[model samples]
Target chain A: MPPTEDPDAISKTPPEPPAPLAFDRPAFHQQAAPEFACALCGAGLTGQYYQANGAPVCSDCRWKAEHESGPPQAGRVGRFGKAALYGLGAAAAGTLVYFLVLWGTGYEIGLIAILVGWMVGKAVFSGSGGVGGRAYQLLAMGLTYVSICASYAPMVVQGLREAQAAETTAGAGAPEGADAAQGSSSVTRSGSTESFVRMAPNGEPDSQPLTQEEMQAALPLPDDPEQMQPGQTYKVDLASSEEELSPALSLVVFTVVVAVIALAAPFLGGLENIFGLFIIAFGLFEAWKHAARPAILFEGPFSAGAAEATRAPALPEAAEAHGE
Target chain B: MASSADVRSPAPGASHCPACGCESPAARLLCPRCGALLHRRRLEELAAQATQAEAADRWGEAAGLWREALALLPPGSQQHQDVGRRAAEAARKAPASLLDQPPGGAGKMPKILGSLGAVGVALWKLKFVAVFLLTKAKFLLLGLSKGGTLLTMLLSFGVYWAAFGWWFAAGLVISIYIHEMGHVAALRRLGVKASAPMFVPGLGAVIRLREAPADSLEDAEVGLAGPIWGLGAAAACWAVFLATGSGAWGAIAKLGAWINLFNLLPFWQLDGARGFRALDRQQRWLAAAFVVCAFVLSGEGMLLLIAAVGAWNAWRSDATTPNWRILATYLGLIAALSWLAVRVVPMPT
Candidate 1:
């Protein structure tokens, strides 16, 4: 009645332009789906798919990937060894720097203890390729403690030298025969003027001056004794001329004693000053913390909807509506 | 004019691709050019599922289904436009649904314990002590950075140094730095981008977030992180004071605690306001009660302002769902900070 419409003619006619959209075109339509199959297992994804790296993954594969995979534990021993070596190197460097600061400033900067800990921890972390663990933490803490303690070595040695000089000056005018005999006996008994001074108030000394050979034997002889001049008379004043007799050997012995003291200095210092101990503890805690494996907790399985909500309004109309 | 059916359906033996407008044989399930699903039946199925999900208040699922349906419809079509709008609306509601869910293991605690009140809450959170400390330590270590943070810190230190002397200025500036880093750490942990701490002398430091937090819980966590770290720094100073018997450390500890406690006042954009956003009416009252108790016990004048603001918040009708972990953290922080603030008198330095 409207003149029977020719279906072929109707199909040949161009379609009318589509109506304007009330909303922007969906972003998902721009990219073609990579596959209908799961990326991980190659199984067909019919329903309830998750995305990993923007590719579809089946639930079973996603679960397996999340639960089964973790950081590898292999080569852990080698990592620890490397960490230990690095920590030791850091400790040596830290100790030298700390000593220099102390020497230059003449102040015990407590903050330096924290710096030492940080350095050792960072070194250990780097050496292990950032694979940190309990072993690494222990190594870092140990190295840091040693470094802090060892920095006191120079100070301890200097203190000992000054004391030794004071004792030598105090005993310089004593009668040579009596003092020599007392000093030799005391040096033989305790190998130090410190103990000799303690016993000096009570001990009676022999009046006779000892022969050079007897004096040498009684005293703790240096490895290389100075040769006597042909006509020179030797005075057996052990305290005063002790340095002249064996300066190199005395220094070596003093260093060994100071090393032992330096090793104990941290604990001894801590005992005397609790603040120092706490500060040291803080530093050690920093090292221990930084060297331990960081715990990372993953929270998700979130819907892509949330992401879409936060996505930028890229469409010009949408952007204008949002005043972006 | 074309009938609705004619507009929706293609000619016999052929169909049009919604995505790319390509014509294809009806037998083919996908568009030849764009690979978009050409089956109108599939779009109907997705729309049906989305309706069911919406009815069930599963906004996330509904949003996902609507999105799928949107892809199948021809662009600019009424169905496509409607579904797109629906998807966006559902996405907006998804975060509210998330907020309704209990966070982590706190949901598993006996309801009786919750009914037992704040003491029970504190006791319940005792198990989280290790997690709390570990989290703080992790964030503290992660927040360390050079360059901008260091330069700004030095600038702030110089400003403070002129006023408070080097020792107090150093301690104060460090306390503020730790506080600001707490925000940076929390933001980073939540995967929100933020700038490093930038100091502004007397105004304290700030880290600007590049994006808004997804929900109130996220907002509160970021807000409270600063005070938590500030508390830690204060506690450390207090411990140092105890060990060294230095008046300077004592002063630092006292001032640090005071500053952190002051940040707990529930006003404007301060951390306490952010934290209060996560609390329900009852929880807000409880927090207010704790603030009052802290003020009475500690005799800190600053707590009065906090308590007043807290009381005002409690009185308001706008309230959120109760988050016990946040409540517990807030209460614990108030108690610990109040104790530190009062107990450690700033000795004459």
Candidate 2:
């Protein structure tokens, strides 16, 4: 029932307002009946209230009322469209996940935030991967990537220097295999590959592509001398850089450039610590680059880890060949 | 309790328009006794003229020359009006003029921003309850900052009754009118014919230029004319407070600085809004970062939150201005100034 003009309608208030009327009531009701039509937009409305000062203002006008500036003019609705929307949603979801992860696992969500932003930016504005479209994605990715990396520069420099100092001290008291492996690797040329070999408990080649059975064979019986627990490392070996570590000093310049750009944006919202700064910085730079040429900023997706496993080199076979 | 519209619009140049003629401090601009260029000099023309004058010894001729320019016209003249609008416009464009004024243009964008933001704030505020009178008043007052009659804060407190109650409303009138006056002064200083304050609902206040400035440099100053004009008003307030020992004037001074600073925040829907379109991308990014940091520190998370939403909308934010660079300098100056003031003059005592 339309709201009766009677103030007595307060006494006659229905159990509850009719379910929220769609913004356009005329179209909805006119599909079958008569109802209040929006004075401006012609959209229909329910629970239309016609005051003495004016005609019935519907939910549509009401919504417009709620927002005074109104949406952007018909043509320039907003600065962003799909990309901004995607990034905003992604950021929101990513932030939510970080909050949840912090709640569950006490680990920082900073790293994940980096990936979230990258994805959001990439989603709306295609990364360099797209054959077409202005190179906006690449530029944005580059700026953001540089910015994120910059956030950790000061700490990384400090950490790396500390690590090098410890390595020098530890080298004096080295385990036998470490130095020899290092020496061999150093002896290799630019394209030369180095490999490490592992001996089976029984001194076998141990190259049967370790299924659970072969994996179990490498382990001793539970009651025997050598059994490892589930998911535990089995003879792990860490790799050293075939080349000397890329000079940490040089990266500082690139990092600073990113830091400056990140700090420059008007919306430099920081997240959990590292990722937030990086994301905000990246977003700002990306926005900046796009504002400029836009074509130079695009970059395609390039995560080596994301590649299929089959496509990756066969590590075990190579290790075994070295052993033979 | 009387309807303010009842106050006559002052006899056209007989005594003068409200701002220049009336004893009421609320008036900011007045009708020219005879100055009529009606054709405001676009900001671009002013810039072109200012450029032409630069090689000459213009600086040496500043005061006398400016006074001569001002004599060509007259002092000029809103609210729910905002605080910073007048001061920022004045500080930025102290020598507001038409011949010397740049085309500080954005089409209808700023108005849209103001209207949308105001409406959003109102809706959110009234989300708790919706009654006819409540919602009607909400709609009516939502974007009334540019509504003129609502602005009257800068008026003498004794005239609060005349202001129709509510400082935001009164201040809107006083701040906007005074701000426009700053523009009139600047334009006159450049010998550019300019209009008195022109009121626009929701967008606050503006001074129309009736003619262009004599040169390019004048135009640049004219582009900055509005801000300088408003700043001059603030300086006047500051000086009065110091000399007269008026605590109320002190309050106005504090508000003036802060409001101007806020307007120049280099964000959406503010004076910086103009800067957004004009600055480069790198500048904008840096400015964005500064703004976010400032908001977080100032506890304006809601703005950030809204910006997050805006970011989403502007994900395609094709902002191609050196906004960040301009913002960096302006905000840095404002922040430094604010800090110095706080240290030297405790805020509202």
For residues B205-313, write the lDDT of model 1, one tens digit per residue: 7788765554577778899999998998999998988898888888888888878887887776789999999889899999998888877887776676678779998
Show model 2 residue runs off by greater than 4 Å.
A1-324, B1-174, B184-194, B199-203, B208-224, B239-245, B265-270, B292-329, B336-349
Q: What does the i-RMS of model 1 come to?
A: 22.2
Interface RMSD of each: 22.2, 33.4
Q: Sort candidate 2 into its docking category.
A: incorrect
What does candidate 2's lDDT look like per residue over B1-349, in tens digits? 1000111122211122221121111111211111112112321233334334433534323323332333232222011011112222222333432333323422333454457797865664454334433433343343345433334222222233232334434444455555555455555554455554555432345555565343323443444444544555566666877898765566665555544544553343344444444444554555555555655555433234323433343343564533344455445544432432232343444
How do the candidates score on chain B by TM-score? 0.61, 0.39
For model 1, which pairs clash?
A275-B243
Q: If scored against the real structure, what TM-score would every candidate get?
A: 0.35, 0.26
Error of 1 at B18 (Å): 13
Candidate No. with top TM-score:
1
lDDT values, one for every candidate = 0.66, 0.38
